[model samples]
Target chain A: MTTDDQIIRNIISGEQHAFRVLVNEYEDLVFTMCYRILAHRHLAEEAAQDVFVKVYRKLHLFDQRSSLKTWIYRIAYRTAIDHQRKKRVRTIELEKAPMVADSQDDAQVLMERSDEQQRIRRGLAQLKTIDATLINLYYMEGQSMEEISEITKLSKSNVKVRLHRARHKLAEILSRKQMEAT
Target chain B: MKNWESDIWRYLASELMGTELESFEQALKDDPILADKYESAQRLKRNLKDFPRLSPNEGFANRVMQKLPAGLNRNLWVQKLNRKPAWYFLGGAVLLVVVTLSIGWPQGSAASSDMDWTQIWQWSTQLPLSFVCLISAVFVLLLIDRVVTR
Candidate 1:
């Protein structure tokens, strides 16, 4: 129930439980972003955990120039990209990328598990890491372009240009698949 | 399909406005292909938006929390340095003055060759005890910086 500033202040004051609250608060956002970018559960988990550790290490340097969410997302995006590069996987490979975890309610999950795993993940895999991350930030996370630019270190114009390219690429890939099926 | 590159994107992202928005809207109604592409693009965005989110398994928070505390206590001096840099800055300035003053023996004089250990000892004896303490403090500061930065 504590405000983010109060949580940050408590953490800077060396309260261990305050950090726990922070980790809990942002774990899902960090983990989901990592998983989508890397398309590997284990790597995403490691990256997410590393992000929190880094946040703790660098907490004292948080100068309050940006909101806590923006700062943390920057760290998360940077860490995920670092791990993704070190793994040398580049972008997520649809062939190897795991299907979204199994769920009875998820028809897409069911479809992905069965015959057409490549339908969407393939298009996403073709995207550059920055481009895929742009889609995730915009559509999935609902971040504004300004925030996306801050997180990705791209200029606003660059974000707009790249996001448009990414969307077009996805449409082309999906439409090509449909044409092939017909 | 091809023409939807920039305008359709801006329209669906709700970024297009004023004249540009009206023109795109008119085009959407006038052109079947453009309208179809817009619908498909919207579907693409909706699907991406609804992409499944992955949550950390139970106790993920505890695992990360457990790893943080050990490193937190490792750099005690850095914590102090971050908290109060002014004191350290002032201390460093005083140390510089003391070291400079203490080492300020008249040098390269006409009698430089004749200066001996006895003369050096005499020069040292003339310096205040506080100068010697300041040199020791400088050494301690260097050691702390090494440890903290390591």
Candidate 2:
């Protein structure tokens, strides 16, 4: 396995093909993180691509103070947030913006596979971006509060408090959805 | 339902420490309702953990690789220049002093032990042209880098 430092050095030294190793390694992680925040497959894909482009441009500034993955996660989080903000602005301009249709069938198929998972996703989608991201970082990725704090630039206490509230909110949403279904 | 909901999440996260963890465990054993809530929270956690990770559509990596700008290597040089400009300036200054000293004072001006205004004027005139040439050379190199990378 080529180490991250080696891959970085190779890319910096003008071997662009070496970048494929990096893209391959982090694509799923970056895509999943983006998807969790954006909640649309096509938008998430676009955001993930944006993240890689930013990473490539800024790779020279990576000082190695933090692990490569954490740095990339921070970039991914910020990029997705930026995309979400731009998306919100565009929706406002359009007024009565169309629903994101690309991912609906994929989401429906996945929901059919597991009702509870879909319920959780619905609950997550309703939460604030920060809260949902915290939940994804905590439960889905199993990141510790400290790691989440570093990635999100929130204080440790803030990550804990938000995560606690996020879980309760998710539970409330899930119970309400269940009641509706019954 | 109660404030213990926060405690349940903390405990699930394994963030509750020492006495806090102990107390939560004790409460879990004592209160049937709390125990039931804990069970459900645990189930929710399991579902979240098991949630499938979504991959981007096929050839996602290829798409990303294709979209990567070809100018990154040239940008890296620009970034390096932006990061440590002092070194380049110092090198230029040293080169300027060496070139000036190597030209040696005009032989007649030095022998006469006089300030030769005409000699000084000629040297000063040549200095600006040399500086301009140096800057143009740098600009041309940058232009070449940009074109080649593109």
Candidate 3:
């Protein structure tokens, strides 16, 4: 398989076909990162598309100082954050509406595992955006601290400390849920 | 010893393994509190790892592809070169060459005499203004191109 760097070089050199390979390789990771941050599939999809478009436009500015995946994920992270900010502004203009109450029967139909998973998702949502992102990048995405530092532009030490704190916070959230269940 | 609870927990998470592992394990064997914290840390690590992965929808790629601009298929060099500034430069250069040739090429009998000393002096004096105008026009065109493209 062609490396991502090779594909990017080819794309920059005018082979449009090479971009398709990059899109295929990174779409899932980008989509997942956006989804984790935005928590809405449609918004995540839009963010992902925006990220790739920015990537294509700005590829010339890419200096090869970092890996292609790191650069792309950095773009994805920034795009998702920007989308969220815009969404927040728009949401503020609308009148607050009461959240729809799920029917008891519908709630009961969800499996315990599914419910637990939802609780974890909710706990993740409770985290500050950076903390949540650090957890997602470190755990779900299986990125190293150095890679996370590059993507987030944090120092390696900061990445380590923040990740440790975020994990503890997540564990506390999960433990509280476990207690509530019992 | 300084409190290595955090370090022990970090090691268990595999974030602090390798070189630090043996020293931490040695510390753990001697300190009961450290061992207890290590156990809790291990549980937390397992719990975090066990969270279900979220997979993208099957049409996710198709949806993203649909949102991209159609012209993105063009080659990168072609795309970059096709920007307004490049075209402006090319057009300006062509116009400069056309204007220079037009002015220098005199009709019939005048063509030879155009190079004569007196005529050459006249042309030399007029050339600076024309050159300046051409340069100014090119500059203005470039500025206009940048604003419009933006």
Candidate 4:
């Protein structure tokens, strides 16, 4: 298992295959970010490809000051946002949850996961992309505030404040949605 | 005590440490509302994780890799040109146009009324339109290449 720094060094030092390792590692993460932002699988896939290509071009520009995950995430987020703007697709309310883990999980767990996903998707749909993204990164991805601040290019204080507000808003939206559903 | 919201968030985010964390834990044990908020946040966090895990299609990495220029393979001229932006191609096109106009304008301007129809025909053929056409064709090819490649 090569360290991220080693992989980065190898890529920069003219080992082209080193980049494939990076793509394999962060590809799902980039795709998820793009999917959450774009809400379209086709567009998200396209955005993910663009993000990887951009990462290759900018690999030489990356200083080792930050973690490669943070750098790639920032690229993913920015790329997704750019695609969302260009397409201007209307955010649709999620009607049914796809059970990606249905085969692996017991029925009860799958049910909870499906319900939870639906509620979260609804909450996200109600919020702006950045707000939803902040909550997604902090909670879903388990990113620290400092790491998220770097990815967002926001001050630590600002990231913390905004994250709280976003969560609170999401909670409110979820509560409202449950009320209506009930 | 100053900003309990920060404390509550830090506690939920697992960012609280030592004394601050100890005090918050005590508060959570004592206050029902605070504990309820904590419970709500925990539920939210767990549910958030279930939002979705979207992975690209199977051949996604290969497609992206194919699109990526052979960065380390600098020996490949196509890779070298592929790395340049569409703006560079556009600039090359504009430069070609300038050179063509500069060469064509002088000779075309000199062909006046004294030149017969056949002379006019000769002058038109004398202009470097073929070279200009070739350059323009290459420019269009580059533009199409950039759009398609991206």
Q: In terms of lDDT, which candidate is strongest?
A: 2
- Chain B TM-score in each of the candidates: 0.44, 0.43, 0.34, 0.34
Arranged by TM-score with the best first, the candidates are 1, 2, 4, 3
| Candidate of highest TM-score | 1
User: Could you estimate the TM-score for every candidate?
Assistant: 0.70, 0.67, 0.61, 0.63
- Worst 10-residue stretch by lDDT in candidate 3 chain B? B10-19
Clashing pairs in 2: none
Cα deviation of A77, candidate 4, in Å = 0.9
- Using Cα atoms, each model's DockQ against the true complex is 0.28, 0.27, 0.16, 0.23
Worst 10 residues of 2 chain B by lDDT: B10-19
lDDT of 2 at B7: 56
Docking class of 3: incorrect
Clashes of each: 0, 0, 2, 0
Model 2 regions more than 4 Å off = A89-113, B1-6, B10-36, B75-82, B86-150
TM-score of chain A of 2: 0.85
Clashes of 2: 0
**Candidate 2 chain A: worst-modelled 10 consecutive residues by lDDT:** A89-98
Per-residue CA lDDT of candidate 1, range A1-182, in tens?
43988988777777778889999889988988887787766788889999998888777667777778889999999999899889976564655545555332234334434334346667777778888788888887888888998889999999988987787677667777778989
TM-score of chain A of 4: 0.86
